[model samples]
Target: MDVSAETLIKLYVTMQRIRLFEERVADLVSKGEITTPCHLYTGQEAVATGICASLRNDDYVFSTHRSHGHYIAKGGDLRKLMAEIYCKSTGCSKGRGGSMHITSAEKGLPGSSAIVAGTIPIAVGAALRLSAVGGDGVSVAFFGDGAVCEGAFYEALNFASLKKLPVIFVCENNLFSTHMPVEDSLANPIIYKIAEAFKLPSCRIDGNDVLKVYKTGQAAIERARKRKGPSFIECMTYRWRGHVGPNYDVDKGIRTQKELDRWMAKDPIKALEKMLIAKRFLTNGEASKIVTGIEREIDGAVAFAKKSPYPPSDEMEIIRYLFR
Candidate 1:
């Protein structure tokens, strides 16, 4: 697709920023700096970066537990995200919502839910509202393969189809949902086919290829914006970390090292870097500089999070609804 050099470079930078941020979060988690049960979005950066690139600042995006990449790619403030994970008062959710529940309406990320398919219906509602107001804005819901098994997933799809809501359902099918492989969990492992049952336009693409993802996402977003109704995109990607920690799950015998190595070899960040280099959009020195800049940005965000104060004990009263 005849994409401009500037766009390609931006995609590369965004993916790199996510990779660096997630890596730093992993380090902080290991050092007890972030006590939240974190889910790293290391290997799945391309999917979020490419898809969010197609969305407007006003477009709504609902995310899942693995959402740092989604939030960052959707223009969320890096410092506030770090603070949220650190449980500081200056967080986007005011320190009440940790890693799994970060939300920024200003950035168009309404919220992310830890529940498997929790945000599906929320995105549908957002899209329905947008349609009622006669706007072209689209809402996107990002979920994993595990969420497809949830009844909520089917219900959301059925409603979206019936209403012709302006929404995009993106499933980051990374082969395994937690410890179970997709093959073992589903009678028919092809996820995009489920969308076909809803009579929605759908396709699966290589999530490791940022450009491919961008092209597909652009088409889907344009379709929604034009009031063509919901489309489903199944991005074939992988998570480099375990389900809820910073370590590789291969050590637990859930996934083989060979499988992890294969996906790592197809690293989305590296793929984009190589493509940019090949297209003369960037050189080795320039790529290195970009990486350095991202590292500095991450360092600054960490410093901000560390210096931010935690919420006062009395503030617990503000969250009294949780007790009931």
Candidate 2:
């Protein structure tokens, strides 16, 4: 797996940015500054960073509720994203859509939905439209393991396979959907097998390893661009934070502390750093400098969001009328 030094550095920087951003968001949520229900993408940073690195600026990405990492990795503006979470007028959605509904058409992120599996069909539709126009850009749908149980998941996969649409289905299998473990929820528990059943090219990779994810995503994207049809990529990863909050969910007794510690030990950011240092791609001092820069960027975004004002009361009514 030969990757350029520049690409590897970019991947590391992107992952760091996501980690800092999510950590800041979690702090804000704890302080009640960010009132929105934010699903922090703390430990699953590598999946988004690796996958989005393979995408062009024009390639579309449909995201799930845990969308901040996807948005940031896909080149979304940090200030606008933070402002959106703060429900300010300068937000990406003009404060209309909060954390779960961030969208940036300019960045090729059409939108994300709060409802599980809601964006699957939307991504398939977008792929169909792209196919009709003979566009070379591929569309990607980022969903979780829980969505596989939904009818929309099967339906979207079936249609994409049937039409050979240029779309990539990325399932971030974090082992749990909300509080329910995969064992309790899924009868089979293996998601990639379902994609195999659809006769689509599919593979499961270690989502924590950015290199593995990047290589696999590159292949999937290439297949889609070649019009070889949709591909399913199951990324086996874990989320460090609770299902919906900033705290660990061990208190709820759904997951054991031992289980959480085991996953935490495989922290993607540290793993990448270790690999980079080992390969002479980056020095410890250089990595520290990179992290410091990202922290400053995150701080600036937080300050920007804080200074931005909320939308006027009348503006909400006008938006409602327009949408209606």
Candidate 3:
């Protein structure tokens, strides 16, 4: 498969967008301006950006509590995203869902759940619809390694594989499940191997490497769209922030500053920028401008969110939004 200069640059831009956006979100959370509990996606930008790079607009993506990257990478509106985080009426989910629960049906991000592995079955159901309705679209489930412990994860995999449903199970294994390390919780530390039991194609790769993720994801997406069967990918990545907030977990004694620095050294945005500059696909100056543009875009989104109205407070208006 051939990779173009444009595609490579686009990958870099998307990673930068996620990284910058998440950083700003962390800052906002620190200031207490955004009241929602945010699970920032900092070091793991490449996993979401690369996987989503080759996806079609109609293909669905279900995400986890750390969902900003996936939602943005899937072409969600930044303004709506920021608004939701700000809990404004104009936000996606109508400001009710906040950071963990965001959705844009038109953009293929049907929804995300704060509960670990909550959306896995929902993604399978979407794939079931496509399989039954004869659509080419495939559904993708993005969850952390924590989900692997949940029975719903296994059930979703089995049902999808059995029915040959068009779905991709993307396990964004960021080394730790909340504060617990993967090795501490899982008997078999190798996550992708579990897919073999269900007879699905699977692999584990360096999730920090955008090109590898992009190529592998494209292959799986292609296979699923062809109606062959489901595929699984276990992405080994790191989270730079705390499990629930902007702080690195070092202060909590769960991890160390040195360990965090080592991961930061392998920062995905910096890695991609190095490659792009080496290939003459981009320059430091060009990259700075790209980051500036993204910063401006994010600034606009923040401004929009701050100015937007909060969800209506009237009892009847609140009742209108409630479901049966």
Candidate 4:
């Protein structure tokens, strides 16, 4: 795919937003403003941005715990995302979901959950609806490498294939399931190949390279839109922070500093910026302006979250949501 200058810039901007947003959330969580556990999506921004670039506003998106990147890339409101993490009423999930359970109906992001492989089945259900009702829009499920171990993943793939539903299963393989290395957890460490057993077209791509991810994602999404059933894209990426919390997981020797550094060197944002600058698609001045703009947006989101009131704590008021 010949990616244009505008697309490249857009991808860069989206990745920057995800990176900055996650970084800001980490800072807030560190200061105790956010009381809940947050699984930061620090390093894997490319997978979401690249894939989401192919989706329409009406296309469905289901996300896992490390969901901030996906939500932002899918066009969910930044203020709502920040406020939700702050447990404020203005949040997309009405402050009920916090960081891990964010949702945005208007953006086609129904919800994200902390449970392993929880949203995969729901994404399949959405795709089934799209197939039955007749539409080209596909449902996408964004999950970690750990999700492949879940039975729901296998079942979802089977059903999606059996009925020829339009769903793209995107596995962000960051090489670790929480603290444990992916190699130790799965019988077969190769993730994308697993979809082959279910007769779905799948492949592994470099998650750090946004352009590659976008091209491959476009193919998978087009396949689903063509009613060719599900396609699995295992993007090999890495997360910079701990399994849960603001701190890096290296303190307990969960992963060596050297290993972390190696992945950090391949930072998606940095890589894209370098490519854009080298290609003369982006100048140094524009790069600085882009960063400045993104930082200002992040500042605005933080202020909104800080001022937003927390959801009503009264028993009756809380129960009202259950009825709705």
Candidate 5:
């Protein structure tokens, strides 16, 4: 894959926006401003930014409980997302759907669900719909490693392969299902093998490396767009926080400090920054300016969400049947 100065800058900006947005959300949740169970995608920003960079506006993308990074990567509005997290009336889901359920239909993020692998079949069905229409639309499913153990992931893969649906099943293998490591949960723990069994092409890459993720994603997305078939990518990454909170004990037995330090060395944002500097895309000063600008934008979004009123009591009553 060729990297130009402009493309590198765009990636840097998108990753920065996602990182800052999640950091701010963590603060908001910590302060008790947001009541919903919040999941921050701080350590997994690279997967979303890299993969979504290779997609088009019309291509569908599905995400899991830890979905903020995917939503932001697919051109979702930060103000509306923050509003949704805060449960304000102006939110993307009109404040009814909290953080985990955020969606942007216009950007092809139909919605996310709490159930693991819930969106796999949904993406497959959407891919089938696109196939019927003979459209160029492709669907991407972002799920955790735990979701791969679910019946839905395998069933959807089989169905999509039988019909050659234009879908990309991406497993964001953070090595844990909530508090438990994936090893304790499954025998054949490798996600790519599951896709291979379904007769689909699969690629396993270092999810922390943004360039590798982007290149692999580009190839898979291109294959799907051409109506060849579905593809799978197992992204080996980690989440810095607990399964459902902002912060936790670093010395906790669930995750070790040594692993954290190793992953920190491969920070996607910093890696891209070094690349940009080496390529002369921008100097230290320019990079600082860009970071400052994104911080300001995120602050503005937070202010917008905070000032926005919560849903009226009667309005909440009207939206109870949204799924129906």
Candidate 6:
């Protein structure tokens, strides 16, 4: 399917916003302004942007710890996202969910969880509900390669396939789970094979290319809307920063300088910016203006979160029930 220039540029902006948003949050954490553990999604923007691009406003999305891109891609408000990271009352979770648990039910983002593979079953459950109600909407579960080893992911996949539910399982195989590399963790690195065993339609693609990501995701989403069995997409991407922080070199033992430089050359934000210029949809001046504008918006979000008060401790009891 041909994506219009306007639509492509919007996706680029969303990806850039996600990258900058996470960067700013990391900076804030470094400066002690935000005291939360943040899993940055610096280089994996295309996977979320591409998948979310294919989804409707009513479709559901479940995310994992590395969810800033997923949340932003699915139309979560940046101001609220920043507020949640800052633990302010204006946050999407009312200052309790922190960086890992951002949620926007109105936008079909039920939430991201800290537990690995936890959202897989949730996405399956949502898909079952949508199928039962005969809704056109689909559900997407965004998880990492490590999550596949979990029993919940397998069970959810089996259920989704058996019921022919409208769900998409996006496995972002960044090749690492926390500090461990994929080679050390899984004997069979080919995740698509696992999907094949389940007889689910699946494909693996270069996650660095936003257009490729979009095309594959679009096809899968179209199939899901037609009530086809679940689709699994394994995106081969890289993370520019460490697993949980801004320091790119903090975990040098697992990631070498060569690998980092190689992935840096394929940065999603830069790739999209170059595409926009080559297509003449965005001039150099326009691109600069867009970056400046996004920075300003992020700055405003930080200020809003900083100025907003945290929920009263007495209200904590009321908030606890919402999680249940």
lDDT of 5 at 287: 88
TM-scores vs. true structure, each candidate: 0.97, 0.98, 0.98, 0.98, 0.96, 0.96
Write model 3 residue lDDT over 1-324, tens digit each, in one string: 888999999998888888899899999999999889999999999899889997888899999999999999998999999999999999998889999999998899989998889999999999999999887899999999999999999999999999999999999999899999999988898999998889989999999999999999999999998999999999989999999888998988999899899999999889888988998989999999999999999999999999999988889988876665
- Which pairs of residues have clashing backbones in candidate 6? none
Model 1 residue runs over 4 Å out of place are 315-324
lDDT by residue (178-286, candidate 2, tens digit) is 9999988888888999899999898889999999999999999999999989999999999999999799999999899999999999999999898889999999999
Candidate 4 lDDT over 1-324, as tens digits, reads 689999999999999999988898888888888887889888999999999999998999999889899999999899999998888999888888888899988899999988999999999999989998887989999999899889998988899888888999999999989888999999998987789889888899999999999999999999999998789899999999999988888989899999999999999999999999999999999999988998899899999999998888999998887898
**Which window of 10 residues has the lowest lDDT sum in candidate 5?**
315-324
RMSD of each: 1.7, 1.3, 1.0, 0.9, 1.6, 1.6
Decide which is better by TM-score, 1 or 6.
1
lDDT of 5: 0.88
Off by more than 4 A, model 6: 250-252, 315-324
Tell me the spans in candidate 3 whose CA falls farther than 4 Å from its real position: none
Winner on TM-score between 3 and 5 is: 3
Cα-based lDDT at residue 100, candidate 1: 94
Against the unseen true structure, what C-alpha lDDT does each candidate score? 0.93, 0.94, 0.93, 0.91, 0.88, 0.90
How well is each residue in 90-165 modelled by candidate 5, as lDDT tens digits?
9998888898899998888999989999999999998999888987889999999999779998899999999999
In candidate 1, how many Å is residue 90 off?
0.8
Query: Where does the lowest 10-residue lDDT sum fall in candidate 6?
Result: 245-254
